[model samples]
Target: MPLPDPSLLFRPLRKLYRRLPLPYALRVLLGRIYRRIGSPVNRAIQQRILANSLFRPPHCHLQESLDSLPDYLFWGVIDWDFRHQRPQHLAEQLSLGGRRVFYISSTLQDDPRAGFALRPLDQTGRLFEVRLFARTAPIIYHIAPDATLACQLRRSIGELLSWANTHQVVSLIQHPFWTPVAGVLPNSRVVYDCMDLHQGFGNNAVELQDLERNLIGAADLTLFASAWLEQHWHQQIPRTPAQQWAVLRNAADFDYFSKPAQHPCQAPDQGPVIGYYGALAHWFDVELLAAIAEAFPHCTILLIGADTARIGARLRHHTNVRLTGEVPYRQLSAYLHAFDVCILPFRIESLTMATNPVKVYEYLSAGKPVVTVDLPELHEFQQQVTIAKDQQAFIDAIARALQAPASSAESRQRQAFAAQQTWQHRVQALLALTEGTQQQPRVSVIVVTYNNLAFTRDCLASLTADPQGQPLEIIVVDNGSSDGSVEFLQQWATSYGQTLILNDSNRGFAAANNQGLALARGEFLALLNNDTQVTAGWARTLRRHLQRNPGLGLIGAVTNNIGNEAKIDIHYQNSQEMAVRARQYTWRHAGLIVPCATLGFFAVMMPRSTYERVGPLDEAFGLGFFEDDDYCRRVEQAGLSCAFAEDVFIHHHLSASFAQMPGKQRQLLFERNKALYEAKWGRPWTPHVAREKP
Candidate 1:
């Protein structure tokens, strides 16, 4: 009657196919065919399997093991037993420092027992390996998850948190797949550990670049593995504070690699032994290896590690080269000791240019002579390591390294340099950065809302999109909305822990803002309109400029739709294009400030001291029109200047509430505000105009 679930027939075939004894090429070809033909059915079966695994209770030992230790959840990009690179090294160091770490692997398992499995990596039980059992592909390869899978993953993570009895964590995310997971974690602080230019990976889709952008925006602290990578991101997203990102380059385990190997690997006794051990993928230089083999006919070119790109075929004919595939991490030191010279022969590409190789640190730690290709990250270590500019130079460097004795003074200097660059030192620096983020200066962002709910929602979304930029204390004042804005504000305020001031009747714009200003408690205060959309790092950029100039009393951001000198002409069709244009504009005008007679109050920031000295907006200009001009005049009268930050951009939907007002009523309100402003200033009011581009 049930039609015997179609997936049941394919399960055994899938298991058998994986276990079949076949050549690497044949296995790959067969796997691709299987995936192509069975994709839809397999996805359905995987969804069913995951659905059944939810709400399962944790093991009895898990609770006791995680007790009393501060927890760190690593949304890992690789399996724990894989390459033993940055992710594994960092987790091990954190665990050694007395923190419990749960590493959720990207490699999934197929088992009927449970939805997930947790196993301790060692006896201390501080480090745990998490394996999610599923038949579908890992979520790391996709830009987003489907609705069904997303619901299951969220519920699964919730169950994990409930079992552990913790409401918050320090989430160290290594890839973009974990971005959505970080959003659902209650009050969790996110750290983005960017180790590579992910778009350069061969198997990854181009869409992952966009996902990485989202993850970077969500992270509280971003750690780049190389100076080049940090500089790359700096040019892409300009105008952020220096404290938001740091270059925590790759390092080695000094004590482990410095000691002599207990059992060294056997090598050819006659000629020199040239060695390299790491992942041999698209970036690996197989042709370079062949050239090296041909140049040194008597040398034994030992190539160790997993050949993921199937490069062994290219070098199989070389008689002197030996490929020992996929060695364990503990056995690497043995091979390093047996080598006469170590060389890194990687292709010159975008991915390899940004790589801060861990093997170089390990090779130097072992007191071996090292020669590497031209990589930007290796420039700092040119004194201790031989950096070659071309293929011929690389080969020559290797010959020189081979001639040098292992116990020379140069070897001791290399070892000394590496001792200071250990995993422990790197971990300590990382922990210090996290601690620094916790002490960020709080900023109060005040937004006054009227009847337009759609604009208000978009404004709040843009404000909170970048949680990593500046710590904000959001205060929202509602001017009696009949369009269900109050109910939405109530729920939003509760969700994000924001302050809401709900007035029973329509309060004038200046008066509503005054209410929020009175309740504000921050070193910096920003006034944002409900119809504006702000760019990332807007507040931090404005705050940095304000702090740098003591004479400046108030600052406003350049916008596309503003009436005064702060307006800048911009061209964009959509939000994504708008963000790109904003970044380009900000980078072009970085640190350039323009003194303005009057800045629009639609978006503005000032220090608390300035606010205290200049005082509040005049409520006499009822509704909205000339309160900003009045405030600017007061700031100048108090012996301070008002300026606009040229490095920041905010998008304004100009006068959303005012546009709805009747023509006669709007004109009357504007004329009344003009008279009140002119009377106070003792002169006729002149409308502001845009400044000429410098």
Candidate 2:
């Protein structure tokens, strides 16, 4: 019998919608429908609004944006109105330099235009305070109750994006509703601030589930609020130069909450106020709270916030306890002013599993003694807060906190502790997420150019000045660049011949990379974008990590306008239109490893062995998207991993090549190539690319 043609096999499966069960088929159809309708419309609107903006000043240079972002920025957005306050402890991380912040939603009051208003549970006072107080860099504490709602609001307010034109750094503290808007920032580099396990919102569970996936696939970088979220997002967004996912966690606000205070007189002189505040729902370990409250009758307990109905009323009857019934944010300090201890009685549900409790930061901010159930995300903060192993241990911890006296030294110690957990510190940690050393490794840097004379010159200058300087070999892959590239390469070749490869046509990313790879003598080869300018020591940092982690086959770095280094481009298009337009500019902060199948011809590195084993990036990938991802998958399948070197960075101007192509032509090539990629991989490019970082 003759073997079946592989292409024919997929031809039949393409009818899965007609043959499969209704629900599964509907899901597939709906997804493609949404992407088609939503993506282009949003992109067009953002482009039109930002077209002539001042942010893209003619004199702006790639190096200038990299240097202007202040290296770090602290950030957070609110999910509920009460949790909407600025996390001061996290903010302290930005003290190293002039820090800057942008809130898609916030409670700061000093500035209105800078802060977006949130639909409050109580729309009572000032709606939401919008503050623009930072002298050099500002902090935006954007809060959104429902991310679904936020997306719609963002579209309504989409034109206001021009306001962000002048800002150096833009971080989107994404709630589910923000995904659509979060994905399309015409003028700003967006960070899909993934701070929690979004799918755990039981009522908003379905929407949350979809939103979580969208944010992971869309945002440029994701800042997980908790370790659980971080690990989860690592699987979703991936960590690579093209994407970034970092764990910033809910951090404490020092000094403001660390001041020593006397206990409140409202509570009958009791043992201690074992308080747990914020939203109360399924995530609240009802049995645990009851067990602790009932097990220890002498301790005075306080429960704050609405939605305490989920916890049984029997626990409410205790004479030693009081439900303060949703206190105002203004009165929170007063309530904490009287508290002896604070507790986080969380249930080990999916939410808790990946949550970085905002109250944890609040409790620490208040300098109140804290005791709570142990969680992986809190392990870093364990030293500062009192952690309980179980019910019995929780009771014991509460007793210890109550007995402890408020002291100046203790307050100073708490403040000191809070100081270490600032957003700047988190940003630094984020920037250095990829563990690569300063020592340079053998590197072959390849730049592919078609036109754009000015961009190619700057990119070359940057490559020549690379700080790592690891026995450098620079090869300019001239893919039929009509302008001065050929002449320029020849002139530079008299001095740099050992490094240049002048190709005749635009043989696409894969073919050109293959051509460059054929001549690469270095252990590691870099496929750089011609429109991009490298920062100091960028190559050395990527080389060090790939060298130390033997299992690593590919490494990517943070770059401007290539989406955040944490999340995939949900709006990813293969056509030239998808590339970063020459006029567009944005900022990126971190780096991470990409596990999904990707087209990484732009800025990536691979060992020569990888090229030999996985074979060159599929030439069928033509000009863009999926080639690098497919190659990386083959590498991972071969027992190697891809890495994102956060510290190493480059500035990429979007869509330099594809930008010149007509829309339909670009779309046709993308679809045809996408079908080919799926045929070889046995799966469409998913949010999670199977990978294990060495």
Candidate 3:
């Protein structure tokens, strides 16, 4: 009669927590915030600091000027957001300018490079109570502007401009969305950073296109992170010698990513380790991950990061895979050590092709041989890593990496390659570009919802609740949903009235997106899915990535249950099989992909202009499936690339609404679509692309 072990009693609870809902995610966040800011332990530390007079607040001070002039930077989404490529990387690099710099941002305490945190204001609002601190250079913060209180911002701006008037504010650098306001800045010079194609977003993309044009016209200089951005803009603008649009290719943190594990490691007991580390989002090739795990039952697939619950439902069966929820940055080394081979199984699209994955650098740093789908972003690392052309090729590459001798030389080569691409270097380039400009940054997000009311509500809620105070608008397109979705959206629109379109009957994915795209007025447009739940800083993550790489055609958020990361077979012969597979795969590959023919209807973001050229998603595909593929094909054909974000992920419950549909109908659609796809691409649809090529 010994007491039951606590571990056994709590195991099921822990699993339940792993599958917590969106509200739970927020509750957890609030709890953490409370603990950090209110808990006795934190209070004690603060008390100690106050007693010792060490509790200094964040500062944004102006210092002595140097020979070189400081620039006016309208930085967007810098410090608070935790993505691979954020504004901090740019700030750190810009600090290298060796000149006095002035920053016009909100809060300003979020970025570490700000080198200061803000303190509470005293009565009479004299700004700081002599708490103004300084960095190596100056990064002034006059809280970011928004629609709520223009008078207060104007006063703050007047003071900030008075200071800028005295000092030589070299240039104004701003994100595309802020173009409309960047023109209002007192400073004469302006620079536009076209990061992503933003208009395709479902709801908030109305102002992006107009904003981008204004920003481009107002800018003395223009720069882009992705090749597609530069090309797209360059084509639009008549050949002007003064136009300085450069493709600031996305770089990796080689130092952190290129090193090898210091200790010998072993995989889990069941099989060889094939793993993916980073955010598991909608753009991930979840299908590939699940298929690979299934194809090789002898392998243990490890996903090291936060649990992606809704998406994980697709991969519950595989006993060979396990999701080790988010680990501390310091502890990541140990997990990478356990992986024999790293994987970059991702959905190919306009968003993914233009991306520069940070994990690529981390994988190389770990000195673990890598296997990934052929993404344009990874084209540079093809020599050092294996680029899989299709599902079979992806599997083959994993096999090759696993079979390779775990030699130190191979490891060293990876580390050496990684050493060259540090976050510091990327930062330096940003500093160089924004040396002299004064432009405010604004962003517009376009989200498209067809009929998924619950999912769309979640997505819209996240945007409205974003911590960043930057000017943002949401353009939502409701494509004739009969599920009372229109009513729900109309209610939301009452509060967030900008642009909301309700179509009569479903107009297909492309046409609905086109409808949204037509109304985009921001400098950038972010296309999102109605069936997905986004994570913290999802918009900022996508924004920063696109900002850093203008050459990108599209960018996407990570999804919890994307492609295929589990081994649970979904080729169900009957409803029973489907249910069993669902249960099994859902448990097995909680954060990995469950095999899919293509990336699902979760999330994708791009600029407004890309749509102008690529047109809209092919309407012929109709409701769903193959539409994204056809769009991706158009992107590739257009020479613009797609990229996947490693930071943000949306929780997507795969084919949930379709679950109740008649099996015959689904089969018919599948066959019809397969035939249509084969007619278009000259190949029958299959789980793997081997049959088509070989």
Strongest candidate by TM-score: 1
Identify the superior model by TM-score, candidate 2 or candidate 3: 2
Q: Cα lDDT of all candidates, in order?
A: 0.81, 0.57, 0.57
Best by lDDT: 1
Q: Per-residue lDDT for 31-83 in model 1, tens only?
A: 78878877766766656655554335545455332322346788888889888
Q: Write the per-residue lDDT of candidate 3 for residues 272-329, one digit (tens) a residue.
A: 7888877766666778978888887898888877655444656677777777766666
For candidate 2, the TM-score is 0.49
- Stretches > 4 Å off in candidate 2: 1-67, 70-81, 85-100, 106-158, 166-173, 184-192, 214-222, 230-245, 261-271, 287-299, 308-316, 328-331, 361-368, 377-393, 400-419, 431-694
**How does candidate 2 score on lDDT?**
0.57
- Candidate 2 lDDT for residue 462: 70
Off by over 4 Å in 1: 1-54, 63-70, 109-115, 133-139, 437-694
Per-candidate total of colliding backbone pairs: 0, 55, 111
TM-score of every candidate relative to the true structure:
0.61, 0.49, 0.46
The positional error of residue 375 in candidate 2, measured at the CA in angstroms, is 3.6
Least well predicted 10-residue stretch by lDDT in candidate 2: 120-129
